[model samples]
Target: MYTFKFIPRENIAQIIPFLQILDVNIPAETLEQRLNEMFDNNYKCVGAYHEDRLIGVSGLWILTKYYIGRHIEPDNVIIHPDYRSRNVGDQMVDWIHAYGKANGCVASELNCYTGNTRGQKFWSSQGYEIKAFHYRKMLDNEL
Candidate 1:
């Protein structure tokens, strides 16, 4: 069995290695900068552990937007490759759902990359529906 808990910001680095499962390939310095920025933005990460080993992580943000009232947005969800098909994702998501409810979140939202078909199926199984496309443009960087 796995256990879930929110990882405190001070120990956020623990999730860094697990990020490799998501194909995170960036300079160490840049990744550190971005992670610190996320920490400053109140990003909360939940970790799924087996005894003493961290096996999964998912980032979350509880925000109140005009359209969604209050919602929990999940991002960077990745399970360790070694533990992928053992229900770790399901339990981690369930933990997030319960956390959101306790924090008064009215909805949950997430975006799965187009090429990640497995991720899409997992989210669908977790009761998420695709409502709209998330479009982005580089406003300050070269395309």
Candidate 2:
């Protein structure tokens, strides 16, 4: 059985392992520092637990955009490999939706890698449709 809770910043460390599973290339210390910085900027994390151990996590950022108005954007969603195919991700998504509505968000948005067909399918099942392409470029030197 799994339980869901809004994790506080101090307990954010508990999410490092799950985050690593999603992006193994990130250094642990860098992830920790970044999470802390996000928390300082109003980012929130919700976690799924099984028998007192965190097994999944999702991070949310509340922001206002002209296209969507006030919205909840979820990032860094992950479920431990051991717990996949058991609806944990669905539950987290459900929780995020409810939370977004309760907090006056007009919409919820998330980004999924184009290659992650399985994840895209799941998001589609949850009523999300692609609206735009996200682009990024890494700077080799300070601007």
Candidate 3:
């Protein structure tokens, strides 16, 4: 059996290695910036651990608009590769969804890369849909 907890910032260092294992693209500076912004914006971070070892991390942001009262985005969700296929990911998603709902979120949105078919399938299984296709372009430094 596994245990979970919402680790405080003082305990964040213990999870650095776990985050590295997940290979998430968030850089330290970016992470720090987001942490500060989230504090200012009232966003929150929740994590999961097993036997006192960090196993999963998720970042959530709440959005409010004139047309939409409140919405949420599961910006990042990562589980150690070794722990995949054991329903940890699904449980994480469910927890995030429930957290969002309880915090006044009317809906949640997430985007998975086209190449990540497994993730696409998982989200689909969780009842998310292909709302739209996103496009991005990188400009030359000279431009």
Cα lDDT of all candidates, in order? 0.86, 0.87, 0.71
Error of 3 at 91 (Å): 1.1
Model 1, span 4-35: residue lDDT tens: 88888778678778665566565555656777
**Alpha carbon lDDT of residue 10, candidate 3?**
55
Please provide TM-scores, in order, for all candidate models, with all chains considered together: 0.92, 0.92, 0.74
- Give candidate 2's whole-model lDDT: 0.87
Better of 1 and 3 by TM-score: 1
Clash list (residue pairs), candidate 1: none
Top-down lDDT ranking: 2, 1, 3
| lDDT of residue 67 for candidate 1 | 85
Off by over 4 Å in 2: 141-143
Q: Which ten residues in a row have the lowest lDDT in candidate 1?
A: 23-32
Task: Name the better of 2 and 3 by lDDT.
Answer: 2
TM-score of 3: 0.74
